[model samples]
Target: MASPIKSYVPYSIFLIALLLRPSSLTTAADFSSSVCSGTLDPSRCFQVIKTIPGGGQAPSLESLCGTAISFSLSKGNQFHSYVQSLAASASNPKLKQVYSSCAENYDDFIGNLQSAQVMLKRQDYNGVSTMASSSMTEVDTCSDSFKEGSVADPSQLIDKNKYYYTLSLIILRISNKLGGAA
Candidate 1:
């Protein structure tokens, strides 16, 4: 038979390990809930973070925001390519013009997003917010082109456009929160 002291050895080690773990060690759900609490759409913010592997487990707001920014950048690149294809495939001159214009907007948006990544790396939260806001403006410009007198986007980029705006808005809000955290 095992002695009582020996039987408790493993449990004691477990308890000590738990105690020594840093307070910063947090579950993904907890991280997402706290990060999304003050965002424009907390549900969407949480969902976005969940899409990113290990994003919700970020130890700091800055790192989580970095994940979000990278996600947005990936989407922006995809959207740019799609818009460029739309422009190439468009038969109507006006439609072609509109898509071409949107591609330009995406170019600007992507540039801004890249700058935001740089700012986040430098811990310049304000710069991140500025660039994110610029990105939102670029999306807005792309959207506005659709409304210009029955342009009639056959590709229905508008639906995709909304997500771009929301992602940028999330980045902006998160960066602002990071500013407060600083």
Candidate 2:
């Protein structure tokens, strides 16, 4: 027969290992599916979020918010650079003026996103929503510049801006939900 102490030692080690292992918690699929359920493009939302580095396992609401905020910052910076380049390259003074406005608009957009990120970290849902909404308006401001100028809209820029705006909206919505839950 096995000694009682030896039998207990194996069981104790097993219990210790189990206790030390991190909790399964939430998977990325679970989080993305739940988060994207109400969005217009659930699949696109899931794909965009899951593709972020370490985003495939969003263990908490904070993790999801972080990923969204990071993506928004990246997109905002890219848009700012693109508009700056457009302003620099435009030969027509009128077009150059509009592009310069766009560049400034993008600067405001990035500022809003940065504000939203800070609010998110502080768990200030109302502030996050306000900042994100403001960022969306910045995109509209840029688009309207072309409309008011009676020039063709920059389709590519508009599309990309919309995509980034949608991501910000998603983050805002999630933050609101978390606030309500709290």
Candidate 3:
């Protein structure tokens, strides 16, 4: 017959091993899926972003706008400089307007992303999360607009944004499961 203490020791070791294992190890795939789905839903984006460490703070609309303004100015200046370099440039007013509008929107999006990155660096989880969610929403809108023919040739942008968003969401979920976030 086995001694009682020896019998319990194996069970105790097994329990400890089980407890020591990271929880996220099992649900990584699920989190990846959530991020993929969230690309189409801002709410989902919010949820996913909230799970990441340094990603769950609110953002100031004013700050976002200011960033947008600066981004737009820089973008506009660069485009103007590029246009000046064109030797035989004959600008179409309509095309120029469209391009400018697109550039502005792009700048705004980039600004939002930069702000979110800063928040993340500061360990402002909530702010980063909120901004990330908003960014996801913007991407979703861009995707839908492209699909609806409201935007032209958005495939490259969609693919690029989607890939990063999905990766972040998956990483967040895994981190959460790992007890990186409460």
Candidate 4:
């Protein structure tokens, strides 16, 4: 038989190759599904925002929240920058208000997410669930209020609400996955 070192060389090389392989080999479609709740298949990014949780699906809320949190973390500064861009670019006072309100809510969502994460890490399952549920309700209320309000142009508001809703869903999903109530 060959020497022990020679015999192990192939196995070691294979292991090294596996470790060095890239993990982000997903397609745009796959990325969309993971971020946008499988509604991004048609290239309609906004469609992902319109999905509502139903059918007694407990995981829906959690999924939305988790996705939102991920999005915020990945684009927190960029989101703020966009808000500033809107504020500078929009001439309508109502539009400015809409953008400002959305920005504020985005900040609030991020804060709430941080708090929820702490609660989860502390093993405060009840607290985590309670916070997630309350936050989700707030997101719904904000979305409805913006729709009904005389914001003139509500697209920005709607987009912000969608982001918040997604985040709330993600938070709920993670909490439930950690054995907390959805």
Top of the candidates by lDDT: 1
Q: Using alpha carbons, what is the TM-score of model 4?
A: 0.51
Please report, as a residue range, the 10-residue window in candidate 1 with the lowest summed lDDT. 22-31
Model 3, position 28: C-alpha lDDT score: 30
| TM-score per model over all chains | 0.78, 0.75, 0.42, 0.51
**Which stretches of model 2 miss by more than 4 angstroms?**
1-24
Per-residue C-alpha lDDT of model 4 across residues 43-141, encoded as one tens digit per residue: 344354334323123244344444444554445446656666775677787667666665665566556666776675677655666666666666565
The whole-model lDDT of each prediction reads: 0.84, 0.76, 0.45, 0.55
RMSD of every candidate to native, in Å, equals: 6.8, 6.5, 10.7, 10.9
Model 4, runs deviating above 4 Å? 1-71, 134-138, 152-160, 180-182
Cα deviation at 54, candidate 2, in Å, is 2.7
- Kindly indicate the candidate among 2 and 3 with the higher lDDT: 2
- For model 3, residues 73-163, the per-residue Cα lDDT tens digits are 3543454344333212425544344344434444555555567556645656566556545554554554454455444542254454463
Top-scoring candidate (TM-score): 1
Q: What digit string (tens of lDDT, one per residue) describes model 1 on residues 1-182?
A: 98999999999999999899866766656656766787767877766667765576676767778888888888789989999999999999988988999999999999999999999999999999999999999999998998883688778898788888877877887798778751
The parts of candidate 1 lying over 4 Å away from their true place are 1-27
Order candidates by TM-score, high to low: 1, 2, 4, 3
Per-residue alpha-carbon lDDT of candidate 2 for residues 1-182, written as tens digits (9 for 90 to 100): 99999989988999999989955775777767767887778877776676567667667767777777788788779878988998898877877888899899889988988888888888887888788778878878887788787765443666666666677666766676667632
Question: Clashes in each model (backbone N, CA, C under 3 Å)?
Answer: 0, 0, 8, 18
